[model samples]
Structures are given as structure tokens and as C-alpha cells.
Target: MKTAVIYNSDLHFEHKQWESELAFWKDELKSFNNRLGELVTRWTDKDVLAQLEHYQNEFILHGNVIEDLQEAMEKHEMNISEHSNKLGDTMDVPMFSTHKEIREKMETQRQIYADLKKDFFRFLSKYM
Candidate 1:
């Protein structure tokens, strides 16, 4: 029996791709929530003088976490633009260099953001 041969079944590759994408999105949401927390503090003035309530009101008027996330990403993207494809390259990795590395770095950054958000919310909650 003669049968055509496929070079790459590539099931492993597909599985890995799926896993990475899943992780990226999960972390992405976490990061957005973190930025939103930051925005809340800014909007509310750290809950001083009942600022948290005003922030909650602002949230009702304009509920867009995506903007907050983009605002956060902008600083990171600027750093990438500043360093990427410029005069000299350093050993330090650029955040936007590659898809995999970008995601990895973004995840790390987002984890930090998330932790900060958790702590901020913990303190903020005490007031409310």
C-alpha cells in the first residue's frame, strides 16, 4: 500500500501555540484590571476626601477599561520605540522585540501591575 507522507503533523506545535495564546490572553485581562485599578486611584485621588466614590461615579459615566490598558501599554511601547532599531543595541531585551518575548515580558509586567492593583484595592477597600 502506497500512501502520501505529510512532512509535519505539527500537533505539538499547534498545542503549544494554543497554550501560549491562552496564557497571553489570561494575563492580558489581569493586566487591564490592574491598569483600571491605577486609573481609579488617579481619578479618585487615592480615596482621600471620599474620592473613591467619585471614581466609582466616573466609572458609571465612562466604563472603558480598554482605554486604561492602552494608556498603560503606551509607556511600554514608547520605551520600545525609543530603543528599537536605533543607534546601538544593548544586551537588555526589548519589550516589543518579538511575539514570544514580548508576551513573556508583558506577562511579567502585568503580574507586577496586578500585584500593585491587589495591594491598592486592599487599602482602598478599607476606606469604603
Candidate 2:
């Protein structure tokens, strides 16, 4: 038997807000992908080697876009996620779903690259 469960009065509003947030993020991701593609198209073998050198010289220049993406994720964690508190009450808001796992993983890879800069420096220093 199926039971008809009724949601809270605010559920409708929350649904609308959730839809809007999903749409906004979808657009944002599309834009980001387009920009990334443009960068890839402009990238040549020489450009790739030069960028590698630049990264070796300036660690701070690396992973800036990755950081921006992480900030976006953090913003979602702060503003969107609604989990239970100590009182065992739910926060009645919709957070990103598991489908966003890919995005999270990509960000993690970027972070790894950022961390690798330290290793790169250490390796270079040993040769000096």
C-alpha cells in the first residue's frame, strides 16, 4: 500500500528555490566548460611547455581557476546544504545531489596539481 504523505507548507517555496538554483548552476557550468574549451583550443605544444615553466617559476599562478571552483563548492556547502544538527532536525533546504560528484572530483584533482607545485620546487632545488 502506498501512503500519501503531505509536505510542509513551505515545501512549495523550497521546491521553486531549488529549481532556480539548479538552473543557475547548470548555466554556470556550461559557461565554464565553454571557456575551458576555448583555452584548450588555444593551447599548443609550445604553450603547454611554456605554461609548465611558468607554473614552475610562479606557484601562485597555478590552480587559480581551480580555487575559484572550490570556492563555489564551499559556497554551496555553506549556503545550500541542509543536514541534521545536534537536535536531529533537518534544515529543510536542498543541497547539491550526488550528480555533482564529478565536479567535486575535478576540483580534487586540481587541488592535487596545486599541491604538486611544492614537490616540483623541492625536486628543482635538489638539482641546484
Candidate 3:
């Protein structure tokens, strides 16, 4: 079996990168919401309006998910900082596990967001 080790600086860097990415996605969601509002003014067909509502609802759900993830990441960063302060730069194996879990969550969220963007663009092509 192989062992995986994560250093303090590595975790800090990862947390910073994730924070930046989540913030960017949050802003993008706001822009997408505005675009949906514009679509509302442009089209009134029942089917088109229904699709617009669907995207609007999706943006809201994603915004909530992003907020939750951001909170989780912030907590993780605080924990890491506390650990480093109390125990120096060395981290235990369990810390590596926590990092792995957060990394997986981040990857999953990124993939879902990418898929949603693609689908939204397809919908826009069809309607706008």
C-alpha cells in the first residue's frame, strides 16, 4: 500500500484556489440570472417561459450549493490554521483524509457546474 501525505502549504494553496474558483462561479451565476431576466422580457411563449423558469430555478439552487461549499471550505481552512498553529507544520493522516473529502466535493461541484453551463448554452441557442 502507498501512503499519501499533504503538507501545510499544500492545503493552504488548495484552499485559496478553491475559494477563488467558488467566488468566480458565484459571480457567473449572478450574471446568468440576469441573462434569464433578459430572456423573460424578450419572449412570452408558454414553452419558452417554462424553460426560462427552469434555468432560473437551477441558478438559484446552484447559488445555494456554492454558498454551502464555501462555508465548508472556510471551516476547513480555519481548522487547518488552528492545527498548524498548535502543532507546527506537520499534519496527521486524518487531516489528509479530510483534505481528500473536500477535494472530491470540489471536483464534483466543478463538473456539475460545467455541465449546467453547457446545457444552458444549448437552451439559449434554441430560444434566443
Best-fitting candidate, scored by TM-score: 3
Query: What's the lDDT for all of these models?
Result: 0.45, 0.45, 0.88
Tell me the tens digit of each residue's lDDT in model 1 across 26-87.
56555544645665656545445355444344433222333434444445445544654563
Cand. 2 TM to true fold:
0.32
Worst 10 residues of 2 by lDDT: 84-93
Error in Å for residue 46 of model 1: 9.1
- Per-residue lDDT of model 2, residues 1-128, tens digit only: 99543233233344455445445544544554454445446556675545445543444333344455445555544443343233233333233343155255555654665466455546335432
5 Cα displacement, candidate 3 (Å): 3.7
Which 10-residue window in model 3 sums to the lowest lDDT? 3-12
Residue pairs clashing in model 1 are: none
Best-to-worst order by lDDT is 3, 1, 2
> Model 1: how far is 120 from its true place, Å?
2.3
Q: Which stretches of candidate 1 lie over 4 Å from their true place?
A: 1-97
TM-score of each: 0.29, 0.32, 0.93
Model 2 misplacement above 4 A: 1-52, 56-61, 81-94, 98-103, 118-122
Clashing pairs in 2: none
